[model samples]
Every structure is written in C-alpha cells, then in structure tokens.
Target: MKVLIIKTSSLGDIIHANSIISDLRRNHADAEIHWLVEESFSSLLNLFPIQKTIVSKFRSWKKNLFKKNSYSEFFQLKHLINKENYDFVIDLQGLIRTGIMCRSLNSFGFNKNSIKESFASYFYKNTIGVEKKIHAINRNRLLVAKSMNYEIDQNNISFSYNFKKDQTDPNSIVFISGTSNDQKKWPLEYWIKLAGLFERNNYKIFLPWGSVKEYEECLTIYDQTTNCEILEKMNIDQLAKKIASTRFAIGVDTGLTHLASSLDIPTIGIYTFSNPDLTGVKNTKTPAFNMGSLSNIPLPEEIFIKFNDLA
Candidate 1:
C-alpha cells in the first residue's frame, strides 16, 4: 500500500509523529510511506522508512504569497501530489495549511490532537479523534492505529531512529538550553550551577546551540564553567546522530530536548512557563524526567539527584 503522511514544521511534533511510522511499518512492512513536511524539517523524516518527502516551505509562502515564483512553486507541489496518487494520505498536522494540503490531495485520514485547529477537520474524509490528556506520542499512535484500522500495542511503543552511538565520552551529559521562547529558557545561572554539580560528579557537559543568541549564551556558560564545551551549530541530522550516543541529556523545552528523549536516552526535560503534561518528554526506554513549572523553578540539586537516582 502507498501511504502519505502530512506533518509539517516544528521539530518536536515531527518527532512525536515518528511513532506512527513505527506502528505503520510493523503492520505494513512493505508499504511505501511518504511524508509531507516543511522544508526546514524535511531532513528529520530521512531517519524513518519514508520513501519520499514532499517539501512545503510554508514560512516562505506566507511571507511572499503574491510573488509569481511562490505561486508557481505552490501549484507545482499540488500537481506533484496529484501525480503520485497515494492510496492513503494522513494529515497529522491539522492546521489550515495542512488542511489545505489534504484538500488538494485526496486525503484519507486526519488527526485531531489537543492543539489542532477545529476548522482543519472540515477537509478530512476520515477524522480521527484523540483524547486530549494523553502524551503527544500516544496521541499520534492512537490516531494512526484507528485511522489505519489496526491496533497499536501501547506497551511496545518505540521511537525509531537511524543513529549509531559513537560519542567516545562515557560520562558526557548533554545540556540543551536553547529554546525559541525566552520564558522557557532555564536561567543561565542555574545552568552554570548545574554544570558545577555535574563536574563534581565527574561528567563532561556538552552544550548544543542552533541560533547565534543560543551560541553566544552557550559560549558564556562554557567560559564560566570547567569541562563545559559548546558544540558548533549542527543541522538536524548531525545533531540527532550525536545525541543518540550521548550518555544523558538535560534540556529545557526545546526540539533537541524532545529529540534526545525520543532516542530513548536518559533525557531530562525542564519545563518553565509551560505545562509538561501536554508536551513533556514521553517516549524513552531509559529514565526520562520532566521537571519544573512557571512559578516553580527546579533546583540544581534536585536535577542532579534525579539524574543520579533515575538515570
């Protein structure tokens, strides 16, 4: 069977949607799976069993909708989808943009996760309703299982990846401190103190940054501590490969944090100014802890103790 999954943009959601591919592959081992994702995030889909990735630069289109080049590229994508004639298309991203994509193609199914725009379901031929309280991974899994008419074994949930562990440092702990939201960032002082604690525990700290601001911040933290190194900017694929081999990671609410957790590392997700209940780290074979809240910041000691005990 030929299947197309439309999940666009944002690294965390794409990571969450990977479980569906895992479930699908188990049931239809030979099926040709295609993913429609934003151009920036398309690299992530390469790690899965997807046969093709339909790139949609929504951010670009939104910026220059009136441009002739944008119009031409948009229509070309639609034509390309029609030509493929996929037997089934699932819209995991139930936004107006993705909803429009589903409408352009002959959509077979769509999911209504907690964050979905209610109006997006209007375009779906098959609407899959998921309970709001479940973790994002489970929500995606249930959506795929019900939509595809198969039962997903909750006890066997796993996030599939194509990374080989190669990090030489056995006692390396990754700290992911970059988040787009300023509110979600763990205080720099707290990270510095945490690094001190990790150093005392004989663990090297590895900080990965995506933006210049994050890079500068990581540099500052590196300068302030012992054995804390700032990694060069990495694309999604390179970062994923490195994270897979790391000993453990403690990160704020960010995509890389979610990526580390998805790899089944002993990842710690620190949530501030947000609710971990809806979007915290979920899938992991080892210890994964989500700590802190908006008004309540997790202490450095508590973080280290949790790592020592659970990880």
Candidate 2:
C-alpha cells in the first residue's frame, strides 16, 4: 500500500503526528509511506523511516500569493502529489488550509466535532472521530488506527526514529529557553538561577535559540551562568541531533522540548500559560515530565529538584 501523510506546519503539532509513523510501519509492513511537511520542517523528517519527504512552502506562498513564482510552485507540488497515486492520504493537520490540500486525494481526517475548524472535515473522504481531551499524540495515533481499520496496542505506542545518538554526555543538560509565545516563557531570572544550580554541580548547560530575540535571551543566560554555552544557530535537524546527545532537557512549553522527549531523552516541560494536559509531551521512550499549568509557572528550584531526582 502507498500512504501519504499530510501534517503541513508547526513544529510541535508535526512532532505529535510523527508518533504514528511507527504504527503505520508496524501494521502495514510492506506499505510505502510518504510525508508532506512545511519546507522549514522538512529536514526533521530525515529522522523518520519515510520513503519520501514532500516539501510545501505554504508559509512563503501565503505571503506571496499573487506572485507568479508562488503559483508555479503550488502547481509543481500539486503535480508531484498527483503523480504519486497514493492509496491513502491522511491529513493529521485539521486546518482549513490542510483540508483544501486533501481535496484531490482519497483522504481521511478528524470529524467535524473533533477538530478546531469543523469546516475542514467536509473535505475529507472519511472523517474519524476521536476524543478532544486526549493527549495530541494519542489523538493522532487513534485517528490513524480508526481510519486504517487497525487496533493500537496501547502498551506499545512508539516514537521510532532512524538516527542514533552520535555521542551522549551524562553531565550535559540542554536548556530550551525560547518559545513562540512570550507568555509561555519562564522568566529570565528563573533560567539564570536554574543554570547556576546546574553549574555549581559541574553540569554543562547547552542553550539553543531560533530567532534573534531568543538568541539574545540565551546570551543573557550564558553571561550570567558559569557553565552555560550558547549553541550556534541551527536548523531543526541539526538541533535534534544535538539534543539527542544531552543527558536531560528542561524548557518552557516549546516544540524542541517535545522533540527532546520524542528522542527518548528525559525532558521536563515548564508550562507558564498553557495547560499540559491538552498538549504536553507524551508516549516517549524515556521519562517525560510536564510541570506547571495555566497561570501557574514552575519555580527554578522545583525543576532543579526534579532534575536531581532523575539524576
């Protein structure tokens, strides 16, 4: 069977959907699986065992919709997708934009009531209903199982990846200090204090950033702490590899924190404004803890204690 999985954008949501690749591979051993993802995240797909990775420049196209180049690229993507002749096209992303992309294929997606944009359900050939309150990872897995007419071994959910850790430093820890939303960030003072605790214990702290604002925050933390080092700017693929080599990861609610947990590295997710029950890290190979919740931020000392317990 030839299957096409459409999970177009956003790093965290894509990471949640990625957990089901193992389920598809196990249930349909001979199936050839392909993934359609945003171009920015296309590099991260290399860690999965997929046959093809189709890139979509939706973010760019949206900004330059009237440009001739945008239309050319859009048609080029449509042609490539048509040529594949996929047996199943599943849209794990339940958005209006993603829904329209599935119009030409035999597609499956979330039912109206289960998705945020109910109208998107109208585009799918078959819509599967899943409980809205479950973890994002389980919701994606359950949707695929129901659509494919297979059973999921609840005891065996996996985040299987193709790459192995190049090196692991037991005394090294990663501090994911930046998130897309400012409200979700743990205070800078909290991060500095946390880094100091680890520094005194002789643990090497690695700080990574994606944007200029995040880089500045990381630099601030590096300057305040003795052992903190700011990592060079890297793409999703490069960052994932670096995270795999660390002993543990502590971060405010963000995609990289989810990526660390998925890689089987022990991860602690610090939530300041978001609720962990709805979208926290789950179904990983190692211990993954979600601390704090809406309006309740975790303290640096609390995280340090948790880290010590895990250590």
Candidate 3:
C-alpha cells in the first residue's frame, strides 16, 4: 500500500513520528511511505528509510530567498504529491495547514468530502482521533497505529544513527542547546557551569545547535569549558550519529533532546515550562531535571547530583 504521512514543522515532533516506520515496515513491508516536512528540516528525512520527501517552506519565510520561492514551490509540491496517488494519508500535525495539504492530495478512494479540523469530518475520508494528553511522541505513533490498524507495543521505538567509518567519537557527550521557542531554553550560565562539571569528570562536551543564533550560545560555553568540541555546520543526521556515539547527553527541551533519549542514549534533559512527563523518558537511568519555569532551571550543583546518581 502507498501511504503519505503529513507531519510538518516542529523538529521534535517529526523526529518522534519516525518511530512508526519500523511498524509500517514490519506489518506492511511493501508499503510505500512518503513524508511531508517543512523545507528547512527536510534534511532529516534523508536519514529515514522512506519512499520520498515533499517539503514546503512554511517556516522558511524568514529567509529572503525562501520567501521569494514559496508560492512556486507550493505549486510544484502540489503537482508532485498529486502524482503519487497515495493509498492512505495521515496528518499527525493536526493543524489547518496540514489539513489543507491533505485535502489537496489527488487520491482515488476518499469520499470527495473534506475533513474540517474542528468541524474536520469535512476534510478526511477518515479521521483518526488523536488526543493531546499523551507525550507528543506516543501520540504521533498512536495516530499511525490507529490509522494503519497496527497494535502499538510501548517497547517498540526505532531511530538509527549510523556514523561514517572515522567520525564517530565513542567517548563523547552530546549537548543539545537549542529549542524552537525562547521560553524553552535552559539558561547559558547553567550550561557554562554544567560544562565545567563535565570537563572535570573527563567528559568531552559536544555542542550541536542548528540556528546561527545558537553559535554564540555554544561559543560562550565552548570557550570557557575545557575538553569540549563544538560541531559546526552539521545536519540533523550527522548530529544524530554523533549523539548516538556519546556516553551520555545533556540537552535542553529541544528536538535533539527527544532524538537522543528516543535513541535510548542515556540522556539527561533540562526541561522548562514544559512538563518532563510529557517530553522526557522516565524508565531509563536518564534524569529529566525540570525547572517549573524555563526562567528558573536548577543550579549546576543540583544537576551534578543527578548526573552523579546516573553514573
């Protein structure tokens, strides 16, 4: 069967959605899976085993060149998607944008009536009920399970980070320092102090951030901290490979954090206003130190205690 998965924007959410591919491959080995992603994050799709990637520059409007080509790209994307004639399409993002994209799909089976989001039975020929109560990762997987008639076993989660022959640093500790919203970031001073702790313990800190704005953030800590390596101009898959090799990881509430923990990489997270239960892994030895407000994350010493406990 041919399937199109619509989960655009939000790095963390897209990474989480990847868990479904293994199930799809297991149950429907011959299924053709297509993914739609925001243009800037399209690089992530290259890492996954999938049929094709359809990207739109929804969030890339900030870049002048991307803004100029948005409409042309949209038309081109529409044409490309319609060509697929997918057997089934699922929109995990659940936003109106995704709804519109799903409606535009030129498919043979759907009842011509569109599914309206709030009134969205108007949009999908079939609408799967996905609640917001669960963590975003599980919720996305559940949506796929419901749509595809596959039973979800909590133990089943898959994300791979296979590195090149020489680049894997087995003794590294990856640090994810960027998140989509400012309110979700852990403080710089906290990172500085934490890096110092990691340095003293003989851990090599590896800082990987996507946005150029994060260069300064990583630079600030990188300059002050010893035994640290800051990765430059790296893509998501490259970052994932680096992260997969780490002995441990320290991350803010960012997509990379979820990626590391989901890969089961012995991760420790610094959560902001967001609930750790919603975004963190509890069963693993990883400690998600949540600071009720992003404005007030725990001190370096307290974080050290948790790190030591994990050790």
Which one wins on TM-score? Answer: 2
Estimated TM-score for each candidate: 0.94, 0.96, 0.83
Q: Give the TM-score of candidate 3.
A: 0.83
Q: Candidate 3 clashing pairs? A: 114-122, 114-123, 115-120, 115-122, 115-123, 115-124, 116-120, 116-122, 116-123, 117-120
Residue 200, candidate 1: alpha-carbon lDDT: 80
Sorted by TM-score (best first), the order is 2, 1, 3
Predicted candidate 1 versus true structure: per-residue lDDT over 1-311, tens digit per residue: 88888888689889888888778888888889888989998888777767888899888988998899987887788778878887777787778767766775557454555445877877777777678786777777887778778998765668887656675467988999998899998889999999999888788888999889999999889999997988877889888888888889999988899899888888889998878987888764667789999889898889988898876
| C-alpha local distance difference test of each model | 0.83, 0.88, 0.70
Q: Write down the worst ten-residue block by lDDT for model 1.
A: 106-115
lDDT of 2 by residue, 1-311 (tens): 99999998789988888888889888889989999999999999988888999999989999999999998998888788878898998989898877877776889999999999999999898999999987888888898898888988755557867887878999999999899899999999999999888888899999999999999999899888889889998989999999999999998888999888888889899988887887886754678888998767889999999988866
Return the top candidate by lDDT: 2
Please write out the lDDT profile of model 3 over residues 119-226, one tens digit for every residue: 433456666655555666677677777777888776455653323424545567887787768887878888888888877767788888777788878888888878
Q: List candidate 2 segments past 4 Å from native.
A: none
